[model samples]
Target: MADVNCHKVLMKALDYDERGDKEQAIHYYTMAVELILSIEDKEKREKMNKFARQALDRAEELKGIKKNESPKESGKKSIQTQSASSPTTNAPNKTVPTVPTHSPKLEVTSKEGYTMEEKKVLEKTSTINAKVYVPFMEIDAKERFNFPIPFSDKDGILELSPKQKKEFVQWMRISELCQQPEIIIGTNPDYHAIKQTVVSDCSFVSSLTVAALHEKKFNRRILTSIIYPRNSKDEPVYNQSGKYLIKLYVNGIARKIVIDDYLPVGRHNQLLCSYSNNKNEFWVSVLEKAYMKLMNGYDFPGSNSNIDAYALTGWIPERISIKKNDPDFNGNQVFDRLKEGFHQGRCLITVATGELSDAECDRTGLVSTHAFAVINMAEVDGVKLLMLKNPWSHLRWKGNYSEQDSRWTPELQRILNYDPKMAQSIDNGIFWIDYYSLLNFFDVFYLNWDPELFKYTYCTHKMWQSGIGPVKDAYTIGDNPQFSLAVPQGRGSVYVLLTRHITSIEDFRENKEYITLLVYQHKNGKRIYYPHDPAPYIDGIRINSPHYLCKIRLDPNAARKYTLVVSQYEKTTTIFYTLRAYCREPFELKSLDTYLTTNLQVTGEWNSSNSTAGGCQNHKTYRNNPLYKVTLANDGNLAVELRAPKVFQVGLELTVKELDDSSLTAPFISKTTDNFRSGFCVLDLENLSAGKYLIRPSTFLPNQEAPFFLKLKSSAKLQIEKEQ
Candidate 1:
């Protein structure tokens, strides 16, 4: 009965408040508070207190208004009061309509308990529709940006002139636009032109730069170096380092290569190299040995050999192997050498997108089954290795010989001795891999992307095609997952997006389910469960990680307003690592001041106190690793503001502190987005203390006057309210 009476009193207060009867509203409000206080439950009492505070705050705002003042005048005062005192800066200078800010009245109770204390209710106007205008450019500017790389001398930082930096950027763009050297040197006559042109136009500029730099730094011209591990006594293990080697191959033929004693060999028997002759030929030669080894001395044109061209027949090494029991294994640090090898070469590979259509190529480029490939080789450790890439960020070559492809055969099955399964997938044209070869080879190389900035690009290609069709002039390696060489412009460069977080689990079956809000029911909903499409609960994933998103093709009736409830299933958790390259967006030159004031707003406390300690932390395994977790809440509105002197480059650090840990650390920035609600930023937390943390939200573009607002209540608060 008491609970019912309290509810009735609350309803009465709401009614009087709606009807513009301030005195009556206060009267009912007091009654409701009294009724609520009578309840013995502590939680219930706290709820009543919150309600009472809201009522009182509203009354106070109306205190100064004349009883019969025109609604317009009253409305203006309300707007002014809300903006001037609100936590976020209320800029009155913009031209767009901004949702007015309102200060929340938090009712705090003693942790132990508190007795009810009554106070007089202030008065306020009821029906004033107040509005404010904000500028559009303010909200549209980039919220988070990276600082330009800086060069420093022994004395101090060397600042590049604006014109110099601009020129540097232009050079980079032009270089990227220039075509990369060709990957394939086909036997056909027409392809001869491409190969000749590649060899002709290819100046040793990059090679020359590297050579010159090394010469200037060192006293001699060097080709390659030997890297080895030292013993506990700090003695060089020369023989052990030789235990791992990177054999070289060109045009399907093994070539004698030299190694330097000064080369840095990583624990995992990794080898680093800056240049190679034929990447494709290298790959094919490596594959053939693993598939059909005729001993290191076997001549290519043998008495029993029937084929004219060299092609890999058996096993190829794809991954590094390091065992403590092994005579020279260096443990975890062993893998570091391979990573460095890629860096040395500036190994950026572009891949053809998707499978060429009948109008384009033969079979969908599904891996070993139909596609044949050749690669330039660089020997690492003692093992022979073939480095291949999934052109589509994360897709694997499905053919039998691919690295970690479906286990279809065994390595021992194809020793130098005869085995039926040997050369099994070779006919299908897929490159096969063997683990033994990796240990014997040195390190493989490829390019990498930074995980911090926003990236976007569009490209089309005229490519080559094969298999039962009109003598197709060229096939487009459409959306293929394998990596490609950046063919120079006339020869054509492959358009590709270099990214980290963007490569998500295209196969939903691999990932666990989370809370998902179903906005609309589809007629053929069962299609989502079909084998080809395995993505589960798309809405939440879409909402949480927009920065990593690709194309989202929704039904025509995709809801404009709806709720997506998401909760992690069980104790399963996810961590993300990122690789990225910059994606240029359509530019609109607008003033930074106007952009911040109208388009974006600040969140949390931002007084420039340099309290990096209080900022958000990300989930990181080590101080250098950063991981991010994004959740969709009722209040998720955000706008970014890029504020700096015009024509500036600065390296900005964005971090995420995992809320559930004690150490505030993150792995790496994962994603960047233009839309606040649709996309999320990748988090970086390398310099945080150990603990779970939240994204401070306040740290982005500190001191900038951009603005943003939440469209709904915070989920945590809503849950608490519901429980109460």
Candidate 2:
């Protein structure tokens, strides 16, 4: 009943405040608080506290604004303020509300009267609600997590009580006043057998340690390390001769501390005062105190469970099934424990691998761990030398110029701080390379890989002047009587300098994808692909049609031979071809070999039996049917001959088509010109790169005034053969 009444009063207050009725809002706020005090149920305490906070906020706002009015508006504003200050301001004294009382403070003292000043503790309004008062002194607990302070010496231990922990935690949260502390956990193994047998003794531990040792005149730093005795002869050895480089972790940061059998003269088999020692008693004691505080299910700084730093860093990999060799042991119990630790991000495991080779390591010059190899970039005896240690800790790189040697130069002596003569190099005896050298080496090698690629295109003068200048061209070839193609002129000029001489060709045409012609002129074989000297002439060409619209690759060696086979399911159409021979002076082909032929057997001949190079020959009188064929001899010279073909006209036609950006069609060469050939026409095809394109050609029948759809039985194929 009380909670319901409190809720109703709060809702009414909210409505009054939203409607700008300040006096009504105050009346509702006071009613809500009064209703909350009437509730006896513990569960209703939270509701009461919420109502109290709202009422207090409204009162504070109203009081603060009361004196902020001008003299002109004071008359009206003062009356409004007084009416809003209290719910029953207009009522008699009998209707006045009672104000809530503040909580009382607690005091404590020992029997001997050694009393500390009464530190006023914060009040607890409910089980989960409390207030924490600020302390007079400020202390730093940096890098310390789950730390515990000694309470035995203090006579009045109010701060050590469970109530104090809760109140202080709440106060810290509400006021955002608490500082974070660092935590450290460690694990290791100790030798417990006579012969140090396998799995003789080992244990793991996790704890929170003191960040720094605080004393009157000194502050000492304690680092954490996990150590294990390892054998050198073990396969894929981690350590040999019970010596290992202990992995040290400080505040989640990782470092390595070398541990071996060597110690001060008389100390044997005992951990020295080095950083790798197993003295973690201080941390263990602190954890026990913190664990006690956590037992009551309270969430204070020292009472909460902690997570190791390594776990948060995601160093642990995947888990594996455990196996055990001992008959007395349960199935894989040890492995299960280790696996749990790994999954919980508690274990920090380092994989052992061999050092990368000089080339494998890249430009960084970084050396990987191979059990005992040292890759310090520090200087020794004025010379930078990599120090490697054998896992046995007995054998080292103690050679001629070693740290203890006398043959070292002044630079080397200064680096190693060792001298057979005067020891001028020994300052503090710390190993170090020149700072600049170390920086340069690290920056060059350690940086990640990032790279880019660039491309360029070139053309020739004749190709540009012919209106083809490296652009798309359409040619036709097939069983049709005539094949034609048209090439469009490009904006750029392709000068003769682009192709002064033939070099070598890089091409592939066996597959339908990525067929291109690669022509390169190499001077010193610097950028050349072929080893042999090029013949300084064009070599191989393969294209869709028998016309000149095709790419040619130059073969540095000899006359190139290429086979063009088009496939349809299980069948193939073969088209064998060769280029005409040109003059020795670089001009187009000229000679009697270009014309009539008497004997079909003989190949290279001018004005004789087997020639098909320069001019067109009539097949009706000279041989019933003639075919112009280009062939290459075994001696590397090109030849031409005329043979009989099944069809009358063996040449293709060149057609040109153009379209504007708006798709408005332009006239083709056939529509605008009359000097066009029927059977075969010279195609101006110098402009074309590798990309998809559409070609539309329109034609008509002869003697027709108006043109009609002139479709020809034609097909097209693309080929680019590399020069041999």
Candidate 3:
């Protein structure tokens, strides 16, 4: 039976391979390989494994070829060799530029008249055309139809709390509720028709509302672009096959999300999910269902609209907190920036209210801890006013510029281009409020900017484990993930965005991780020895949000290299993150791997018997610390780092002296860290001659028992051993 199953899967792989569907071919080949390898009989397994392995290898090879082929070569046959004959031509043979096999040699000339060598150095330092990484392939939707509701077993329905589950009910399809169901009701999506229901996804609904408004105002497809199975006009249509595909930018890539038409329905057919006001329209409900499925169902523990907008459209997310005690909170400047960006169609804005008291909520006619979409911004008669929409499509702000406000007049209405009588007729949740009232009421401003505003973009995905670095990084940042950014000598700006990958719903509830980005002005991409040894160029405030944006302006005359450090507070779990950089000018961004070609590491411990835990230079037993002799075969830059438990302060010192020398005087070529730091410290020696040197690793207190790691990195061949 297993052999027959393997043969069937192999046949499917061959069929897909012949049809040029590399993704499916690889999938079936992988299944066949797994099945063949699982056979208990060794002889049978070996016989089938050979064929399965060959098929899998061919499928992987096809995938690689497809990945390397450019879009222009889509329909053309892939050339296996470059030696094939070329068409005869009468034109003179043109010189074909030679491509470098390794790191390509850049021919960029600086306008500052730098020499050839200087240009090469500049090119090497600048990260032009850096590779953008997609950490994983698009996720399989894993759709299931075991039940009429058609819910995926992998992404089960929301596990609501005991109290909430009592009110919950079963799921129903759109066709069962409406006689004539349509994906969209009209030519344009009606922002006013969107309504949030029982699901605790107000932020996501608000995101959809503002996104719909953008599509209506600009006559462009933003929400509809992600939905699959479109008609001839490229508009999303109802799928009779009961399946849909949504492309959402999650983790580090735009992943495909497959869902069915079923939606949660409560008693009396009161849709238990967000939906469009038009009874016949299903796009709003379908889109919400797809997103909620990605988030593990309708029992969403709320998020901000900027995050949702980013997932829907790969935009840059930014959040500005408005606080009474914040000295740097400039309300006017924020409004002006939002006004310019929004009107230019480069920004999507949303505002959220902080936790308000019951009295405050009732008096102001605002919901507590709710998100509102910012639809319009206008300055009329020096009164800065913004138009906002509530996802509920009913309750609105009862402020100065509201519908029944006393400040409304014919002249003022004409200036603002708003009709009070028309607006007062229906409570559509859309209302205008003064800038002062907004600042006083709202606590946060969420902005999602179009990434197309910049030309060059790069992304890198990385993982940081909790045990690898200190839990609280207050004193030293040696274990933090660092990157080197080489900016060109020109006037431009760079934006670095850090996005944390969330793997579960619990990540949205308590958010234990607080992360931020720090930039330092270091030369030659050297590792930072101390936190404040070199003051940070841009010190960012740590926030728990999934996205953090760091913006830096480039000085045309300053040094071209800078270091970006990722810092976290009280890290408790491993985190996978993506660092995406966007800039108008080309620059180089690469991970800082400072380990030299020749590396050596050893582990030792401080004990009372050895008296090797000599305190810093101030201790009497300083000379009893662990000593090692380092022998260099050639001149090279050497780095020595001492690492110990966070409970102890560690330092390293290098001196050119005999291992048996008992002289208390310091050697002429001695190099040491200025201060002992908790966890780790390093000393860098440059242009050292080929010779032997003595290194001392010490703790802050003598007789402190703890294990420590000594690392030696050099550009040339070097050897290190314990010196008795």
**Distance from true location, Cα of 260 in model 3, Å:** 0.7
lDDT, candidate 1, residue 220?
25
Highest-scoring model, lDDT: 3
Best by TM-score: 3
TM-score to native of every candidate shown:
0.18, 0.17, 0.73
lDDT per residue for candidate 3 within 1-724, as digits (tens), equals 7876876676556445534566877898789878988888888887665455455545555656453455466543342311112212321132111000111122222223334533343233222112121222323323322355533434444445343356557766666778788888777788888998777887888888877887888776777777766777767777655677776777765666667777766666778777888988888888888777777666778899878988887778989898756878877788899999998888789999998999998888899999999999998778899999988888989878999898988888987789978999999899999989988888999988777677777776677776644455544566688888887777767889998877766778888889999898865555665566556888888898889999989887874788888988666787777788887778888775444668777756665565676766776888988888998887678888776544455678888854323433323578877666655678877777777799988776676665566777798789898899
Model 2 stretches with alpha carbons more than 4 Å out: 1-384, 388-395, 408-415, 418-724
What is the lDDT, from 0 to 100, of the residue 613 in candidate 1?
Answer: 18
Model 2 C-alpha lDDT per residue in residues 1-724, reported as the tens digit of each score: 8776665565455444533556877788778667777778877665356446545445434445454465465443332121111212222132101000100111211112211211110111001111111211112111111215211211111123343232232211101111221112222121110010011010011111111111001221111212222223211112213222332221111222222222111122221111111232222212222222212212222100011212112121121111233364443343344334333323322111234456633532233332221213343334433332222222222233334555566765555554634423332121222322322222111100000000111111110111111011111111111111111222221111111111011111122211112222332211111211232123223332111212333333433222111111111222121121111111111111211211112111111222221121222222211222211111111111111100111122222222223343423332111122221121122222222222211111111111011111111223211111
Off by over 4 Å in 1: 1-238, 241-371, 374-572, 582-724
Could you tell which candidate, 1 or 2, scores higher by TM-score?
1
Name the TM-score of candidate 1: 0.18
Instruction: Give candidate 1's error at residue 97 in angstroms.
Output: 24
- Evaluate residue 306 in candidate 2 and report its C-alpha lDDT on the 0 to 100 scale: 15
Candidate 1, residue 189: CA error in Å?
26
Record all residue pairs in model 3 with backbone atoms less than 3 Å apart, i.e. clashing. 127-587, 127-588
Q: Return the TM-score for candidate 2, rounded to 2 decimals.
A: 0.17
lDDT of 1 by residue, 536-590 (tens): 2233222221112221223233322111111121212221211111222211111
